[model samples]
Target chain A: MQYDFEEILETIKMTEIEHFDIRTVTLGISLRDCVDRNIEVTKQKIYDKILKYGKNHVKYASQIERQYGIKIANKRVSITPASIPFDSFKLDEFVEVARVLDKAAAEIGIDYLAGYSALVQKGMTNGERELIKSIPIALSETQRVCSSINVASTKAGINMDAVLMMSDVIKETAERTKDKDSIGCAKLVVFCNVPEDNPFVAGAFHGVSEPEVVLNVGISGPGVVLDAIKSAGKIDLQQLAEVIKKTVFKITRAGELIGREVASKHGIPFGIVDISLAPTPAPGDSIGDILKAMGVEDVGAPGTTAALAMLNDSVKKAGLMASSSVGGMSGAFIPVSEDQAMIDAVERGNLSLEKLEAMTSVCSVGLDMIAIPGDTPSTTIAGIIADECAIGIINDKTTSARLIPAYGKKLGDYIDYGGLLGKAPIMDVRNLSSNNFVGRGGRIPAPVRSLTN
Target chain B: MFISYFGKLKGKKVKLSESEIRAIAMQAINELGDNANPELVKEVVEKAIKNSEYVPIPETQSQTTGRVILTSFGLNHPGIVSNVTKVLSDANCDITDLSQKLMGDFYTMIIMLDISNSPKDLSEIQNDLNVVAEKMKIKVYLQHEDLFRFMHRV
Candidate 1:
């Protein structure tokens, strides 16, 4: 029992990586207890919960990072869906609750406030309907309140009716405020049984099972893994795993250092770290490189999905072993505009919405950062989003739609999101109509198995 | 004022930049000793950057956030602290904080901070760090604070 822990610290200090650091240590706090008989009381409860929980999180996360010599990328909070508590309340109450949540998030130095959401995928709860009704106004008025509605699911099959409602909702939300569309896009999302622990926004919300002030970290290193695969060519799957495992292990360590330090600094209990292959439209860091390293000529080639499945699994396997706690939709993302490889693939006719959808089956989420014809009908757009949601709900993973209807683009035309979002070519979808199917408004009922078991 | 070359490889035609052709020429002269042509080198670099990332992964990862965590066993071994810190110090991972404690047979440590000029992955560096840990007979783990929080939670 000769302990030399400080010596280990010296070793880590010797060879630090460059600017790479943990992006976010989000605290997912369930606010179910905040429900109340009076609207004013409920608002206060929401405010109090966020202020107290958020205040301690950043401080704690910072403390841990300081000890381990890592950086915490961001501090944010996600709460229970607003639909549950504001279900019976009026639009004014919804607005009031949103204001309080925004103020709390700001006070605690939290950058993102998620969970100002409603779910209307299968059937509209009275609360769900009201939340949806207020989305356009809430997003226009509130500073930090982001909202999402579960528009469709695969469990009970696609809710075409919900899709139609959501279609109008998006259109109206977009049109309601000219200057706030970015905020609109930032605030609103359409999901399919989205994960409860997602650290990314405009969809993060406290799930029923999450504890108050529980922290979750998101790790990104497509650049590192891509480079490793590049150097280790034509190797066996095991060899590939070895290279990736080594890379992921190191990246996860950096993330863990940040998370633990932040937790200690804030004095709250440390939570799980998520190892997601997050990508941006930056020049060189794309998950597409993994596919390229696997010998794909272009990212969306025929074998793309299979390649992604292997990459995603390999990443998870290595990440899960590195740390005891792992949460969030920890998978490789295929956001077309957010990855340079994907953007090039789209531009060069090697990628498409259909191809992206096919790839999503083996990955997480669908049609992210995809641009479509602006004239694309609301029903058709909803149908597309619904199809993506169906994939998530049936599979029981988080799925989201971030389709951007480029203001004046047509199929084959290109729109640039400038920075991080990159640029994308508009993709085509089937011209057939789903208007009739989407017109019906009612729950399709939960999947049969969920009810029985 | 520079010459450009066009070539076909893998059934795709590419227009090579003049500078690219020169680099190719330079490399060819070094390795192939004039046997390598300017056109060939341009193709190689263009293909290399396109088929793979030009920047190393660890270098790219280092750009976002540099958060860390430190765990220490105890203070029994008087010279242990200096020895433990050498590894991270050598790798350029900035020591943000140091948490050390002494248990019966093991001294525990947890450190948190951003790594400055760290290689692509922390785990890759761990083996090197482990060499120091092994010499001291102590177990060591390196992690990003974000990732560390994720791994430890129930």
Candidate 2:
């Protein structure tokens, strides 16, 4: 007997009681080499590389999951940002590349393929402008392809121009996929301080600096932490934080072990283990529930921010201790549609869009999975991205938005996507216009904090 | 017949229930790992009566928590249950309930474990058991009780 019985049981308890799982095992490949002047050659090269890696990664990930009895929610792929490698392509030509990525992803038998992306924190290059412009068509035309754009960062100021443009792109994407609850918007994330090695999509991409190929993991277990908090029974905040910190260590250790094993078996270098408290729509598997367990009466209440900050910092501390290669957005994710508690709170009118924005300042992301009225001004959407990106830049944290403008749907209407993506109610937005704020189409200078370097 | 777990080199042997004898022996082997000295192990096994965990409690399981069924098959040898339970217990899995069979040279075991209080994780325990199973030439598999019910239910 190498291990005690109790340790084995705790792991089982997490999955059984709380619906704990490895959210994603994304294998990132540098598509930089897939670049070619000829579009056909480029598309073929990308397809071949993706198919080759996809087969092995998925096979090995499923094997690991079966062998260890840990459920993996998704096996995904992230490639080098398309804007860089296919920089010479026309605006519409980039859509063909996206089609190739989508087909390759499906052929590889993966859930999603990310990196239909661009980095325009400071400015957009000619190819990046083409990529950004092609985003709507690419997203609307491809089922498994996810798109992301980094419009702000700590070192780079927020690109209000890109922010404004994405608002329109998102609008078109929503309209194009209106039949499926504007699902195209669901696959697009506007990011500030995006991670290169993120295993989670709609925001995953192999950054310019990543290796030729690597494996990254995203570990999620909000239910396990909530159970511990419940067992602690009205403990003080300090004690609750301590409890979260300890539990996170076990989860992160499990994640690192799984990630390293998969990487070792596939002969790909291990990237990072992102131990985030990402919630699904499942009952009892909610961070909002954890907030309640921590004595916050409502998820979006006054104390919610403090509770989230504690949870986020505690996870990071535990993850840092558990794995030296911790990266990506490793904190509590407050995606509205994906979390049942959040959806309930919003539908019940207790969680307002304003409160959600405030909460996102402390979370790993900003205003994620939120659905707004179809007629809400794209300027307002731009304003939201700008504000969220400003928070990321000034506070030096990762923040993103995956907002859906439910076409022809307004406040109080609900749309369900079933399973993991879950359901979201159309949230009301401030009626007043932010056209002037968004009109200032220039870099919102890097914050003073950026001068630390 | 239960082994005398409290018997030393020069002391009157004290009888221990079957569960007590098994718990202490497993505990010693679990701690010593592969470096365990046979004579020292026997001596510690006899002196393990002082351990509170060695004191058997009435079979009671909390109704709120469910269990997992752990199965192992191997060439028949001594201490199959002892060795398996030792590793599981050391991993903090509670051996609340168990059943075993030895037919010919093949041994089979099924253990009901409540993992709610485990200090380590399931994957780590699996890896450890895998190492031990390979060394002892056994095949081990685990499934949640609900999964077993769904699979075999009419």
Candidate 3:
């Protein structure tokens, strides 16, 4: 036999028992050429291009899923940032573009279409400012379009003005979709040093430098890693890291194979395989469980950051060895709502917003999928965004805030969107003001590390 | 003989006649004009040859090994293997290897098959096996062999 009996069984066990699966196979279609002087023409071109490349995206992905036994969780699309090519559009025009994107996504039968975005890590162009202003209305009106704004980078410093505006935008989006428990906010991300080829939606965009069309895959299997840890009981930290690297290498290889096959089917270029340990809400498929298995009592425990740092490092090391094309946020994600164990930790008061912020410094992304009181002031949100940006800039890693200030929801309440977005408990926030600091509204100059070049 | 000689010159198995080769040279000359050096002429000739003979092979041809691993397990029954093999034979699938083990009253069987020559694709064969498994109250999983090789091998 070409494969050992145990090897065959292990492959089956990963898919059937552990929740090992490709998190997303995002088809990135560039809309750089879709711009036109007329807003209607621009919308039509965007819709047509997406349809031409993406009409069979879900079909091809499902076929590949069946061919292999591994399930692909999401078949999504990302486009060139709207504010880039269509820089002449106003707020209303951008909103119109978002609606057309929603229609195209629905037509092609994908759940989310990202890249309704602007990258203003330095300063905003007039169109970028207008597009940022239109996010609340666009998100409120469209069911499947997701928006992100890059407000800071290590080289460009923190764009304090953009951060402040995004804070207000997040608040307004939360209020606009308050009827659905601020679901609009759930579809928005404020990023620092966001990756262009990221396959995960809500933060994914077809970076300007990316090719006309590409396929990137995000692989998630925290359950597989957790199982490996549980089975490797009593091993020291170094030995445990070996176990994680071995398990992640196998999964990342499988992810790359699947990604290449899908890209071949689309007749497009395969981009990258993001080896992030993204957890779903499914039982036993939680990153928090992995941390617990690493001997942390709960997520907010004192040793949590160390454990996450080791886990994130081990994942990256293994991914690098397994696939040469590892990009995006290639570490562990700790989204509060998307992982069941993390939600349980927050509810039990074992995890706090502050601890999540700390954990983000060592992990893939920052303060993801967290719900706070609706009345939490925009300045406070700006403060949180700035703190995350500070960590990202100093460390020179990608950090983002997908915060849902659940409108009219307070502490002890929950915002449940169910199925992948899962549910987030509204956690307590400090009432301390940042009015004077954020009100200054100037770029935080690039840190000393930016002098590396 | 002429086609093979020309194919050997280009280092590709693409068939071309003497007249076809002359036409390609003529086209390259017309395209490149006076700037054409020997290296540039060779490059244009190769591209023209590729364009003339390109058939756009289906994406699946290069990726698929056409080998699949079919694993089925359920409570021990009288004709479990027969029913599964019947479907494979009907689909023109060539079973390369087979193994089975029975622990107590439950049986697990793994079959390696080369379905390259099959009239039906993997999905259709899977659907056919699914029907058989449903009738027999067994669980069947058909996956491409590359998945296992990629995961288990380096």
Interface RMS deviation of candidate 3: 1.5
By lDDT, the better pick of 1 and 2 is: 2
lDDT at A71, model 3? 99
Off by over 4 Å in 2: A450-453, B1-154
Interface RMSD, all models, one decimal each?
Answer: 11.1, 14.5, 1.5
What RMSD value applies to candidate 3? 5.8
DockQ winner among the candidates?
A: 3
Error of 3 at A351 (Å): 0.6
All candidates in order of DockQ, best leading: 3, 1, 2
Determine which window of 10 residues in candidate 1 chain B has minimal summed lDDT: B54-63
Model 3 chain A scores worst on lDDT over the 10 consecutive residues at A444-453
- Label model 2 with its docking quality class: incorrect
Order of all candidates by lDDT, from best down to worst? 3, 2, 1
Q: How far in Å is the alpha carbon of A240 misplaced in model 2?
A: 1.0
lDDT tens digits, residues A1-453, model 2? 322345445655776667888899999999998888888999999999988777777888876776456788889999999999999899878999999998898887887899999999989889999999998889888999999999999998898999999999999999999899999999999999988888899999999999989999999999989998999897787888899988888788777777876887776689999989889888888999998888888887789889888988898898888779899889999988899888888877889988888888888878799999999999999998988998899888889989999998998897778888999999999899999989989888888854565
Which candidate, 1 or 2, would have the higher TM-score against the true structure?
2
